[model samples]
Target chain A: MISNEFYSQENHGPYELYSLGDFELEDGGEIPDCKLAYNTFGELNKAKDNAIIIPTWFSGTSKDYEAYIGEDRALNPNKYFIIIINQIGNGLSSSPHNSPDLMSMSDFPNVRIGDDVRAQHQLITDKYGIKEIALVVGGSMGAQQTFEWAVRYPDMVKRAAPIAGTAKNTQHDFLFTETLIEAITSDPGWKSGNYQSNTEIAEGLKRHANIWAVMGLSTEFYKQEKWELFGVDTLDEFITGFLQPFFQMMDPNALLTMAWKWQRGDVSRNTNGNLEEALGRIKAKMFIMPIDEDMFFPPRDCEAEQKMIPGSELKVVHSIAGHFGLFGGEGSYYHDQIDKHLNELLAIPVPDKVI
Target chain B: MISNEFYSQENHGPYELYSLGDFELEDGGEIPDCKLAYNTFGELNKAKDNAIIIPTWFSGTSKDYEAYIGEDRALNPNKYFIIIINQIGNGLSSSPHNSPDLMSMSDFPNVRIGDDVRAQHQLITDKYGIKEIALVVGGSMGAQQTFEWAVRYPDMVKRAAPIAGTAKNTQHDFLFTETLIEAITSDPGWKSGNYQSNTEIAEGLKRHANIWAVMGLSTEFYKQEKWELFGVDTLDEFITGFLQPFFQMMDPNALLTMAWKWQRGDVSRNTNGNLEEALGRIKAKMFIMPIDEDMFFPPRDCEAEQKMIPGSELKVVHSIAGHFGLFGGEGSYYHDQIDKHLNELLAIPVPDKVI
Candidate 1:
């Protein structure tokens, strides 16, 4: 078995774990002693009503959310009690990399965005005694969880901000994720998700990175030579130094697990396959923000979803960085836009408590 | 060794080989006893002035070009003598699969668009005594060759039609190709281009097909479920029956070789990296066509190149099929547009020879 250090707070954190014993999955499979890794910033106010939840994206840990949170950022640590939870299958959580043998790798139960939101609900309510969430803010797969939180438990989430993601995974997005998963599992060294170490599947990981190079960012990102902003001179250097190394440290099975969940991310599942009906269920004050250049989740797709959610507002974040713009790379211009919109979202007055 | 039947006319034919002993590549590498696979439709006229040349696209053979050649097609056998030449890396020609042991697989020297056009030029002049091509037409990598033929030997190619491709591969397109090549190479069974039989690299090929599913076709294609037109009901069936089987027959190294050539396609290389100067050298009446939904070679990219080519006309073929529309699929609506354009191009009277 791989050492727990791979998922330990010591190596990749400023985080803590909330253990939920023998958790049953949405697909009817169960994990023995399920745990979720999460980190919190700022302090809960006297009424404990200022708490906001930020879920991690695919392959992201709680630490990956740190860049988006700061004193004066969109996710201001000072103004809001921020709980950034690592989604299951992100290695740091109860993922294929750390789960019991029966529920590891290829055998890991199929997880859904709703399941992650349910776990987040358990963590927030049981651990912190927080009945209402001030907001749920995230981008990409993180945004998927935000949508799920609003639609699945509308009363619990008072406000929600989903950036660079849709209420449901579009067919195009599902196909994109499928290609990414195939890039990893097709590696001979993958050994059908039974590889001894990540090094054995290095080529697969590298190929996975290459896929991101094409789809994770906009075409204009390369045309504009934006890799120079990341301190890389050539495409090869960008791939070698940034893309490859980033995925190499990751567990392929964990990525597959997250990808499977990402592919099935549809709030409509809760409303018996009615997308508009599901969006209608969200009573949260919704802010749907999509990046203009994000090919995976275009602004048009987000705008369509915003129309379905009652009283939801649409904010299109313009950036040539594509989906990666949400990460606040290259001087944080996009981050500022996100911050500006999020502040606007936070400014919306809370409604009176209903019986 | 894989059987030569894989490259023979019996399986994919009506094509014949033209031998060129000890052919030297533009890169200074030599292929001993080089031979090119080609198919000629219709006999050369007494004037030898009605001859047109068509170069095969990536992974395509002369046989694959058969669909676009018929009695009433854009390339009419009755009116024009069409010689469809397979590009070098395509298995039907001299490829990694059938090359001599010393220059096989990973050892196959890099081939370029200019190199393929040069070989096609030699075949036309040496074999058929055809000095002037009435038209040089192709799509994708074949279009790259058409651009090469027009610029590299302007006097020889009277007119050129490059569809769904560019004079130079865009950074976005290059990144897309890199992911494809990486997808195949990362396969454990690839064994660094030394894999035995196509079956060993099945997963890699499937992954490669998956990438095509995302980028080779437009989002609208999936949104409308156009795969139904291809006789496949589900995405899995579309992948297995059409995508996977299509690429599995070709050699991985050949695909890699073609991808490398596709990435480096630049007419500017002929004019010391001055794009405008190289495009200026194209004395051929140019008809630059690009697919409207082709992510790899969008119409805007084609329009930019068209402006550079002196007096070049831009014809955008509108299709939700994306790049695959160039293949004349789904009742060949796109092909009819190409045919109409080519008819207009052919109607332009040839000028009298200047003394």
Candidate 2:
């Protein structure tokens, strides 16, 4: 939803671009000298507890969720400090699109949610000297990172709002993610993840969008013929005509990387072979809300985890907007829910504030 | 699950190998000739009103749901005649696997839910000489067809049980269907659907199963490390380890064709442009139920459709099995709900049968 006008700018306020530094991926594989491009917003409070972490979704950049980080919104720059951490696949960060020494397809580390959270932890703790986060808020894959933060480092963050995210992967989601990655790597343009000049990953990217878009909206929207609003007469037209542009503009490698991470998503993996045990590890107070109509993180799946966590709050966003209901739809409807929940969490007085 | 001994039998009861004389598809495209490999059970009563229809799911043959159509089940031989129609692409029906002249990928005619229902109608009237069905039951893509029957040939069916299905295609679903097709088509072995040998298609089929196995199970299944139940550790091992053999037993062209049909699923496509208006055309009563943990058809989607359809009954099948819970699970606790509804429907006063 970021504007094209914003993308036209040279940089996003004093930001430092990173290279592929020596680091390990979530799958126990190592990618030496991985790169990362990122940006920061708001002044860091004295103790840094006021900092908010925003991780990007699939094909999202540090700039993707920039709209929510300015002076007015939830993570207002005027109050809490904000860090826009670019995910691995995002071109701005170390990605297949700009890597000087691109890894082979087989060598492209199979990253999990832990890898993403761990990397962001490195960025904040190593570089910014920030120790505690007031909150980690995100949507879709980003929300996955937010969840990982609570589980991977329970004491690192005070609260987490995981919206439109699943506690673990489903079979259908695995297939969808696999197909999307296969679409890219197997494409004639892919060249074994090393395509030559004059290749278009549009077919692969279009395929990704087709799958990912379903997770964004609800079945109710489809029944109502919302494709008309998007200006496509048929689903094929939506895939080939309307969606190709976005895909064509994306880096195929980054798409593959992000999809791989999404497919490998699981907090239980971090817990070492126990799902219920992993749920118990989340010491941070959690707000796990998934849209009731969401195909990706169906409320029933979320409810399973809700039942596991002793006192965790589980709210179902009742909207035809599906997964996107967390951000879109009536501002009153979404903001009220978000505000109510955030205020309640904020009211729980911390024994000591880092800020 | 059908027993291996049943599949081994050379004699498949009531299943005739019938080929269609030169026929055109719903899109006005000619198939030159087509074949329908189907099975029938029970007997058509004197009134012809005691007829039941069970349409096949995606990649499913006439034999897939055979256990459901028996003397003791809801579709008992003692009560009604049962016909298990195998949709096109199920190998028993016309597909690139057996067709002398194969349809190219670009030329593959778009087949909708209407097309499946219409073709099954022809089977009933032209082959069996039967007029009406007591019930049309199907799950997943099959469920899409069941609803199609209610909308397309409203007078022909008295009731429909569409499980884990929706009135229209959701974006999430479209992506899954499209990506699966793409996964097969993108394979270097695929050769753009013009492979001289079916080896690549076999690879595509294997990949297709990999996707299916993931989508069918709950994340909890994976989180619990139940791949051991399926006898595997990692997903890749699970994919290459087991699904390859299961998928190898099927025809590749049939898989692609079914995937194509699933993407084009729309009841409204036959009734008119409006989906709700199409629902209004349904003369047959509907019992729409989705698995409580089904990722593809979340319960909220079912609730929304139930609200739209007057007098339609919506029930949630509580099981951890996800999409497959409709036909799977331990004892199927939801079977009681289904049995109760069917018993009530059968007791209702009947009017003159419609031709």
Candidate 3:
């Protein structure tokens, strides 16, 4: 097993693990003594009604969500108690990297967005004694989970903001995810998910990063030389300095785990594959926001799902950063737009009486 | 070294090797006794002016072009002496797979599209005693060679038809090529381009095919389930039965060699990085065709370059097969269009006297 320091909360702190003991996966595999790593800010109010939940995206930990959580941001910790839950397969959570031998890398169970939301539901309702969430928000795989929460437990989620992600995986997105997975696993160093060290799979990780460089950002990003904003002059410098280093630190198995879940993300799976019927069950004040330049989750795809969900509003955020725009890097124009829409969703009136 | 049976003319027949004797590469490396394998159909006319040259694309052999060369096809053997030259790095030619030890696999020099065209010029002008080519046509990497032929020896090529390819590699296409190259090299079984057998790098080759599946075809291909036309019921079947088997037969090093050439295919490099100046040198009657659904070489990119080339016409082939549409499978709608265009190009009036 790898060292705990790689996934420990020592650096990006204030994390807690909620043990779910022998959690059952959607695919019928079980993770013995399963635990979810999460971070919380502010305190649950007297009524336990001011709690907001944010799930991490693929390859992202709860700590990565800190940028969006601030006094004046969309996920204001000052206004509500914010709980950032790391999705299973993210190293910080119950993932392939940190699990026991029986549930380790090669043996890790298949997890879906539904399973992650169910675990988050357990953490919020059973552990924290929270009856309802003020808002459930995220982007990419996080957005997938947000959609799951809205449909799976409609009454429990008052408002839902799913940014730059779809309720279901499109064929194009599935193919893209397949390429990312193949890029990692095809590395002989991967040893069919039994590599000794992350360093061994360096070339594969580099290829994975290259895939992201092409699809994660729009062509406009390269044409405009947006890497200049990231302090890189050439594409090679951007890939080596930024993309390579970031993905190199990650466990390939953990990434594969999240990617599998990402590929299988479909709210309609819970309702016999009837997407319209599944989306119609959403009682939350829904804000379906998509990045205009995002190749993976284009606005056309988001608006199609939004039109099916009763009372759901489709908000498009325009930026050359493409899907990465949702993460809100320095000088990102869409951050304010996302903040405005999220605030609007949060302000929607709910029933004064508790359920 | 692996057996020559895989690349021999016995199975994929009628090919002959032409020795170039210590060919010099654009990257300053040299291959001693360099040779190119080619197949010719029909007899060279008395005038020796009816020859049409077709260069192979990435992973394609001379035999693969046989499908488009029949009595009623675009490359009719009866009317024109069609010379199908296997691009260097394509196994039958002077590739990493078949070269002598000093210039084999890891030692093979980086080849450019211009170098291939220059060699083809030598083969046509010196070996065959052909003064001018009636036409130079191809798709994808083959199209890259067509562009090189038109610009490098403008007077030698009477007409040029480059389909589903660009004169210069776009940032998007360059990134795609990078992924393909990385996918092969990252395979530990690849052993730094010295794998003992094709089976050793199976995973990497499979990944290479997967990338082609995603980018080589359009979203409509998956949505419409066009693989069904290939007699597969599921995506897994399509991948395992079709994609894997197709790529498993090739040499990884050979693929990488061709990919490097594909990535560096910029006619502007010959004209001091001035694309307009390079395109202006084209004396060939040019018909630039792009596949509408091709994500790698979109029609817009092709049309932009077509406008820069003097006397060039842009023709868009609308199809969901994307880049693969150029190969013209069973019941392909665009094959007739391509045939009609090629016939029209062949019918164009030529100078009364030869140069």
Candidate 4:
């Protein structure tokens, strides 16, 4: 029920789950016919030159980020065709919750950011015959995938915008993700990742969400609006009120899968441990914006990348809202700041020469 | 081996555990006479009027915070008496690891911030024979106990310095702590908290510490220092360098017990359901400092308390180190800030109205 209502309102477009074959995930587990949940908006021009790719954030679905793919937005459907791809392990995609055989927790592959992009690449090229993408833009985990897209296929994307994202996973980032994964796998019902038709683990899911929210907003933002943001007058009220909706929407298995990928996310890992070499391999017009208060991918993380990637532009969104400010918040000020840079890039003449 | 060497340093100072009656922990489980291991650096003055109480931080022994109490520091022994009370679950105190009877994970009583102070009260009053404290201070979990001292025994403390701490548990905090407990409990070795005297569950302990460190520092700190901090270049190096030590140094039962108390640390829960009412009970002059960059106890958490406690002074230290900055890093800014206020308090002539 609550999920059905959520789905109806959130997912308004036609979609499909494309099986990409039994690929070995990083965890060395084989997920047969691994499928991805995808949604598309806007008509693709005959040439397919205006196609853009959008990826999901942590515990986010193709539907949540689909709002950005509509008319008048950055990927304005009026001019471009947008494809929202759900990374594997999310509920809509082939995940632990619905997998026929129920993948073993230990055997699950160590999925990296690049793996998601690679899977999406297979879906796009084989199914749609799209040869190029107009842009690849996203925030949080989505932003991570966007960076992977550029690195994996240097010549495929015209430009890339990675907001509130990281080039590679940090220990802190890895730890948080590991914590969430452990929460689900450790549940009595988990049964080593084989639970089916069990009661929702509200306590487990709620605990996971609480940690997630800490990184979403800054201390300043929480101070100013913990009551309004969490929708409660007292701390208990705030916690319970916040968890009620969060638990309703989140799937523990899906959260684990996304967390697994996030923990293992490293484009450099794909290139034999050479991070700078891997980043240097990217050819897309790179624009990296890190939310100043973001606990996951703080501005300094972006700064490190900016210095390493030749010609990469770095814009620090100074706001109290943490990782979530990449969306809008009291830190909306930084949102506008990002838009200015994006507008500048959008206005730049499609270069006279491809070189 | 690394942990043994690290903890064996002269700074650790006379490592030992003291029995504090077999108490029931947060969970209905029971452990016979829990031992609390603590070390003191500064001498207790003659009048004992110059005494300062320093509580241990989460996962820390008295040694972890001892660095701040020596000569030249704010808590210099030459001028003050300092008592460092290790919390119940911190291995040095009684924990699941070294108990005589096999302890069930659920058997531990969820010792709250208040319980920590209450236990310390016994140590000081019964063992040390102290009458009053000039200042009670701590950071993170230690800070939580410091706040408790003021609320539980206002007449005994003249000044309270609670840094990077909250008076109550937030849902977000609970979720994180819960997930941590789940991680340790989920380990196959855990065996429903009955895994005593066998092999320690290193994997689970490693996972718990990994998550704990992530929240303790900011994303910026991670970006700037991950490799250098751990002295490794790759992800594996980082993970191994960081988690291995925690696994070796920590007692699995202690980890679970600490997490249980942290999750249940609702200051108001002890004094009914109202946090403001509990805060209002404090008679000590309060100075609450929350680190601006601390993702765990952000400035907002402290600001919430400042608003509730009458005439409480609030200071926010801007540091990229997040929660850890309150003790080991740029925490000095806050320490200095508190010193200014302490001097002002000391400068004031003692009111003629002595009780």
lDDT of each: 0.85, 0.68, 0.85, 0.68
> How much does candidate 4 score in TM-score?
0.76
Best by DockQ: 1
Please provide, for model 3 over B144-227, each residue's C-alpha lDDT reduced to its tens digit, 9 standing for 90 to 100: 999999999888789999988989888878898988887777777989887778789888888888888777877667766787
Query: TM-scores of the models, in the given order?
Result: 0.92, 0.81, 0.89, 0.76
Candidate 2, B138-248: lDDT as tens digits = 888888898888888878878888878877766667766765676677677776565655554676676677666656666655545445545567766766776677666
Tens digits of per-residue lDDT for model 1 on B243-334? 88888766888899899999999999998999899999988888998998787787878888899988789988888888988666766676
What DockQ does candidate 3 have relative to the true complex?
0.51
Which has the better DockQ: candidate 2, or candidate 4? 2
Give residue A272's error in model 4 in angstroms: 6.7
Candidate 1 global lDDT: 0.85
Single out the weakest 10-residue window by summed lDDT for candidate 1 chain B: B1-10
Residue A327, model 1: lDDT of 61
lDDT of 3 by residue, A180-260 (tens): 998887776998888778988898888899999878887667766788655678887888898887888888999999999
Worst 10 residues of 2 chain B by lDDT: B1-10
Worst 10 residues of 3 chain B by lDDT: B326-335
